[model samples]
Target: MSAPENTPQTSLVHSAYRAPDGFEAFPVGIHHASTVVFPDVATMRSRDWREKLGYTYGLHGTPTSFVLEARLAEIEGGNYCRVTPSGLAAIVMINFALLKSGDDVLLPDNVYGPSKDLSRWLQRDFNINARFYDPMIGAGIAELITPDTRLIWTEAPGSVSMEVPDIPAICAAAHARGVRVAIDNTWAAGLAFKAFDHGVDIVMQALTKYQSGGSDVLMGAVIVRDKALNEQLELAHARLGFGVGMDDVYLVLRSLSSMRLRFDAHDAAAREVAQWLKARPEIASVLHPAFEDCPGHAFWKRDFTGAGGLFSVIFQPHFDERQTDRFVDSLRLFKIGYSWGGAHSLCVPYRMAGMRDGWQRQGQLVRFNIGLESPQDLIRDIEAALMAMQAD
Candidate 1:
């Protein structure tokens, strides 16, 4: 048989070279593709995108993405998983999957700011009724469930306000009403809190934080034990085109092995700093779940095995917002930023009055994300920042 001659362009596209087989490593192989190839047309026709048994398209998932999803699901103790571009994207996927026009959703008062915005958008544009309830509502959540209520969103120890909701109570109430409860379990990274065991129907995590461990990737995942629920989420994923990059998936996979260790380090360091802040006269309140004074602290202690680096503090009324801002500006190690779970510490100040309904606290609120740095160094930096605030 003779090979057919081709133009330079055709030759470039038609190379038949193949890599040797039997190559294997500890790391998962990254498979990047847009148009997935099948051995034959019949095989392609039989392949289902919903099933992870085989690849049909890049958006649906590749081996790399599938591996990442499997790893995340395993970590979270879920049977199925779908990855999204960001934590917010995971929230959006769940909302779009389960709710439609005329459906009602319940959100915690202290839910993530962006999720709150999303609920409002859904109400305004999509006609989905969005309502907010106290994060500590617990069993009382049953009172909020209406005939139209289809979903309830919970964030363990609300991201900014730091109120750890009683998940089992809320889940019991929601499930009784034939409603599904979705939780933003990003704070725990599925290591500290087990959402499924706590009776949550869907668990969403922002892989951007501890999972990445590098602060370089932004990814999220929705995990479920129910096959039907996973199907709904997968359909939404496909319709919304929520595809993630393989490189990011690889980065996450590379860091997954060390996530628990890093998470523990962050936990230990955070608790130490939180304890120090609790004693400071300049700080009115420390809003870490592990702290006894934090709202719903009992619930946190009951349900969680660990608290990650994220926590908040309220400056004394005498310090005011200006002084707090000065203190934050004076921080040398804790950089001002949003999102947590990296090697570098971060600080963010929130206006509770503006963020919450009837926020009664008078002092300014500041959230801290303790990194892998030494707790002593972070405390020293905070001490200096406090002195700077006093000087100002």
Candidate 2:
């Protein structure tokens, strides 16, 4: 009564189906899928993709991405999270979801460089006004908020200048004016500070940094404690069609387990090196939030639990651009690069002339990203670089 085994029907049934259910493992399985199949037509039609009750499409999210999202949300003390292609993408998503024509957004003068660029682009293309406020404005940010202001962006320990801000005060100001507060919490890695606890509505991070820890992956996440705000971000994320590779998500998950350890190591080593640099005669100033001389060190002491491995040092007034370049080039250990939160130490010389509004320090500024290298070795590298500059 049965059909022949070699028949086309039998071949199709056998080749199309295989079940690996109930497989247990320490690591989450990488689910590389674009199309998900349903057991029945009714099941497929009834599924709500937006709620994350079940898998819908690869672009929206996969099991791997969901796992990472949940973990990141928990770490950030948020209820919902959406991962994006990069930190900048997350910022764009927030902007697109929240801002419209006749709306305005406020940014810290010393925010991440690319963020300012994106704000300018939005202003040009979308007619959304972009305003820059001093990072230390704190509650005084209220003065800048207008009837048209819809969003405010904050960055603690302002990017390369390393000036900490009064996050709680800024949040209070923004919230009182009915404006949403979003912070670039990359420096904290969502570990050094509790963003939502300070009244921040949206918290974003460049997971490419500490979460990946290898400096090999580039991914970002936006976390929100409110459901409505989360819905807006989710809609923008889906429309943008941003999707992260499963392998990269898995790498971040793997690194996240060791993130705390690595962060602590980096924090300790950086303090030692910074102190050494501060003591050197060639240094004009060390812009570290943990130290009193930094612009908002008091706020940093009040808000942050710990400092990360990023800080900038201004060379003596005599060190010109050429000398600074020589110093950066002569380093044997610290590689010159833009990003941070890796095992390899990095350094970059920056001209602070036009980047900030109130910057008064003379001489060239060099930012350092301390890595897993021994503190003494990094110090020696800087010492040698200084010596090299002296010789030249």
Candidate 3:
């Protein structure tokens, strides 16, 4: 028989080249695939996407994504995990997984802004009832839970206003009423606080922050200790097709080892800056959970192991919105931005009165995401910004 000659197109489409096995390295290999291969029809038919025993399709997950998910779950003390495109997606997935039309969900008044918006949306279009409760309601939350209530969403120390809530108390109340609780634990990056240990049923983390360290990746994960709960979330995950890119997964894996170190550095630097602000005449209060003045500080002291880099400051009632705006703009190293848990410091001004109910504080609120910069340098930058704000 004559040897067959392959055409250029045919050769390109089906290459005989294959890398040898036993190739080991420190980094996890990035595996990108939409169509996963199967040995036979029986194997394909036997594989279940929910089980995570084997891969069925790229959307479900690849080896790279599976490794990332396992690592995240391990970090959060969870048994199962699902990664989403953004933190908001993780929130939505939880809502869709547990909630249905006519079901009610309780959210803290100081919840993340976009989460509040998502609640409004669910109420308007999905027939789901979303109610806002006081973040410090604690065991008082039992009075608010109706038979229709299915889920309760909490943000430890409300992201913007920085009021740490009593997670154990709220969880106790919710569990008594057969309601599950989910928390946005991004602020701590699953390092400082153990959400699961504190009674949170679902732990949602935004890997975009400390887990990415570089602030270049946008990813979120929902982790749960209960297998049944994870199954429900997996169904929603599959329906939503919340597949994350392999490259981004690899990036998170690379940063995971250094997350705790970076997180602690941020904590030290932030405390330094916060302490400086506490004594300044221009500041009213530093809303850090570690500080005594912060609401729910007692709860924080009782439960939390450490505080991360995020904290907010209220200008001494005298500094109006205009002046506070100038203070934010005058900063040299602290850039104006949203989100935190990166190498760069960020400052953002928020009008609290409108955002939360019963927010009677007199000062304009400015949030600080103290980066990995020298605390002295950050304080100097803030001092210069304060000087510029008073220039006129």
Candidate 4:
């Protein structure tokens, strides 16, 4: 199927562009580039505005880097894409491009913690006003919009709590108000869902996770639908002088070749793990988009093909945070760490009380990122951890 994704590197993308398209992608390879030599001055000018197939400086782009950008856009089903040094940079670039001083932006309460921090930075520095609405606000997001509301951010199955939003409905509502919608599609990784298919205008992804696969590279991408809007974002990006290492781009490209295979494995394994976790008597809930208990499971079922390696398991109501901490500390397999979508298993407890206001929840949440390890072994890890927690 799909030629086993083994097509030669020389093959033209979509069989177009008769230019040099060589170099088989590899996992450990990195193309270090800071300056690009142009064939002529004619090509140099083309890099002036992301205008043509030429590179002016390393910060602008290089052939190696362009290849990865093109492949990411292709896989994500977006017409335009921009790269940033980190996932948060992508978010910052989007804000810098779309928002002006005194303009307002809305974010999901359960969004990534650093995102809130970034928005606050914008608010404090640029006179921008930022507010957080509940992730489950969905179509109700319309009520929060105002004449100054310029950007509306959405995250399907919002971070930590895993509250999937009604993206189509939110997009429609924002479109009606002439506001743009940007989604944190990092969790979906473009394999499980297509943002544009749901009427999203901008799709932001933290490619550091699934795209890099190795957990070594930190890169991000912002895919925009409208070329004109994309140009504006590009200007801000150029001003910020954000540049990704060509080597990191190559790593992500190499990961793309195996994306489908790896994604399917992750999905199947994650589903099994989530199901088992839900069945455990010690677990009060499994906060996974695929689970019916998730806030917007219906939307997840309709829009997403699969889930990644991340999910959260809530301890029984009677369990205290101390007990949960012991379980996490006693885990032999799942290492306690931050971030997800890596090959190694990880577990971390999050206090909802600190993350949000009036957040209602009992028991500590031990977020899990199941690795590529066998499902049975992961299950045993969980079993043993729970056993140790009980023993203590």
Judging by lDDT against the true structure, name the best candidate.
1
Instruction: Give the TM-score of each candidate.
Output: 0.98, 0.96, 0.98, 0.91
The runs of at least 3 residues in candidate 3 whose Cα sits more than 4 Å from the true structure, single-residue gaps closed, are: 1-5
Candidate models: Cα lDDT each = 0.94, 0.91, 0.94, 0.85
> Tens digit of lDDT per residue, candidate 3, span 6-100?
99999999887999999999999999999999999999999999998999999999999999999999998999999999999999999999999
The count of backbone overlaps in candidate 1 is: 0
Residue pairs of candidate 2 with colliding backbone atoms? none
> Which pairs of residues collide in model 1?
none
CA lDDT for candidate 1? 0.94
Error of 1 at 240 (Å): 0.2
Which scores better on lDDT, 1 or 3?
Answer: 1
Residue 125 in candidate 3, Cα distance off native in Å:
0.7
Tens digits of per-residue lDDT, candidate 1, 233-292, equal: 999999999999999999999999999999999999999999999999999889999988
> Scored by Cα lDDT, where does model 2 land?
0.91
Estimate the TM-score for candidate 1. Answer: 0.98
User: Candidate 1 or 2, higher lDDT?
Assistant: 1
Lowest lDDT sum, 10 consecutive residues, model 3, at 352-361
